[model samples]
Target chain A: MNEYKILFTGTMGAGKTTAIGSVSEAAPIVTDVANTDLSLGKERTTVGLDFGLLTLASGDRIRLFGTPGQQRFDFLWKILAKSAIGLIILVDNSRSDPLADLVVYLDGFAEDLSVLPCAIGIGRLDTHPVPTLEDYIDILANRNQLVPIMSVDVRRREDVVLLIDTLLAQLEANTFGA
Target chain B: MTILRFGIPHLSDPEVRLVKAFFRLYSQDPTFRWTIVEGPPYDVLLVDESVSEDVVAGTVLTLTPVKSELPNTLERPLRSDHLEAWLKKAEYDLRNARLQPQPPEEQPIDEQRIDPTSSSHFKLRRWPPPALLGSNPVRVRMATLISRRALRLDEMAAITEQPLAECAAVVNLLRGAGLIEIQDLPDKPMTMGRAGGRFADQSVKQSFVSGVRNKLGL
Candidate 1:
């Protein structure tokens, strides 16, 4: 079976672990530690990478990895992102400025992003409606970026599947020049 | 059967005949009776948009607000299709308005004091809250955050960086789910820049990433 590597990255408390866990056939392997960063508002945070696995209906195997949310460990982002077919950036809209949060990931993966298919999932939209979908579109437009953006609650298995499906669709569109 | 009335001010004989023909076609549905009244007790007003604002304002002011509902705009040169569409929309709006619950005064008030220990009221405590797992990740996060403390809607909005309306909606959802408590907080100035500078090279990297992702068809 063809194997594809997909990476999920986002801010702390953005539910990267939960998102992967929601869809993984087996329990996700997590590297969580006591969070000293009280500002993140979570007791335990992912210190290392989170890993999960899934088999697509087409018989392709997907290896899902979630990078640590903190930028301090961003060096791992590139290491984990290597050879990945697609990237999913989960933005927590409840943060002070979600668009800015998106910018951070977009910037961190600037190199890999040039050649890799990517999808943006804006979470907490129901809680944070500012910098709306339109605002995100405008921000992406100003930067000359056109990628599929959707409001997602990553905790739901269907939502996580949708993000991945959207990424795959983008890859397919690119292949067929759709 | 519901009855819907239409009124047009200063309508010519030809215009009245056209309107009557449209209503006749409309009446084919048979769910409601359609009629054209000379004045007063009308459910819809077909106002010509081409008329002067002053004239339109005067005519509107003279019309009873409660009696006349769903004021539809009629172009100066009316087409049959346009008139038919407008009448259909107006009829829909009037029917919806009628179906809506009346004001509190119009409703029969149930003022009987409820015994909190009664079976119906007692079921409130027995109701199990919904699992925090759902399609909305923000609500799940908010529920976790608010479980630690009671927060006002705006504070939740600010903390979550979600719109006030969305935050309010989540709050309402959680309240319905019986997961968190909401309390009014004294209005205070929101301090900015707290979330600023948490990460370095955010803007530069974000722009580059966006550009790359855009190029990659992400």
Candidate 2:
């Protein structure tokens, strides 16, 4: 069977593991551990990448990979993003500087993003809606990349699926003639 | 000699070949300078009901709803007359939209010279933080579609199934909030010759985009 990959990256506590587990047929494999970074305020964090799996109707397989959200793990982002078909960048609006967090990933995966079809999912907009979606668009506009974005609670299986589907819609749109 | 590009998707290889043949054989109208592009950034796309959701701020020549005889519907069988008419219509509508009068009260805010109707593949710079336009179905649909791609004024109305005025309001709302952005650079007038495999297959990339969608029951 054929295999493909999609990478999910975001700040700590932004729910990459939850997003994957919500959609994965089996429990997601996580490298989460007791929080070493106290600034993050979370009890645990993924020290390594998180992994999940899904099987397509054709018997092909899609690998769901999530990068370690801390900025120190930036090197692995490029490595994990390689060979992946697309990227999903999640943002935690509740963070002190969500927009800056988004910029880090946008710049971190800048090379991969140029060629990969990507989507953005904003988490916790319900309680933290300061930097409206429009603010994020402005930053993206400055960079000249038109990425599909929305507010999502990755805990909901449908929400995670929608983020993936949004990326696919863009792919489908481009493949109109192929 | 300015060339306008048009994308005609969902057609089979034979049909594309026939369209190219038709373009070569028929060039009586010098005013119509259109080339066939496969993917996007075309001045217009001839769409059926299929890829309606994928549209972003660009003009599209679509068919009328089942026998309704819409003014600019690119009628079926891909006749030369229909093709010519639609291409002409696409150009004319774009010109017409640009010519739309600016409200006297609103100052001209040029965010890279907003054209509103250019068939460029528009992508959002960011998503809206909240729906200030309220939660009406039409407004919700407008937000969803616009967030995906920039819409031609008519496409905003057509795809959302709302009045043109309402769609414009949604765009204006987003524009007011600084949520809009033109994904492709504004068009520039350029010359081109129509000969020797002139119609270019630039792209169309969603290979199995629907795979995950199907598996997820979307």
**Candidate with best TM-score:** 2
* Candidate 2, residue B99: how far the Cα is off, in Å: 23
List model 2 lDDT by residue over A63-172, tens digit each.
89989998988999998887787799999999999999999999999987765768888999878856667568658867877676778899988778777866665443
lDDT of 2 by residue, B65-143 (tens): 4544656565556677767666666777777865788676553444434355545433333454333433243454455
Judging by DockQ against the true structure, name the best candidate: 2
For every model in order, the fraction of real contacts preserved is 0.00, 0.27
State the displacement of the C-alpha of residue A171, model 1, in Å, after optimal TM-score superposition: 1.9
Q: What's the TM for chain B in candidate 1?
A: 0.35
lDDT of 1 by residue, B174-213 (tens): 3333333323344444332111111133343233323333
Q: Model 1: how many Å of interface RMSD?
A: 18.7
lDDT of 1 by residue, A1-178 (tens): 4566789999998889999998788899999999999787789998887889876444556678999998888899998777786899999999998899998998899887655767778889777766566567557656756555677898877677667655543342222110
- After the best TM-score superposition of candidate 1, give how far the Cα of residue B62 lies from its true spot, in angstroms: 27
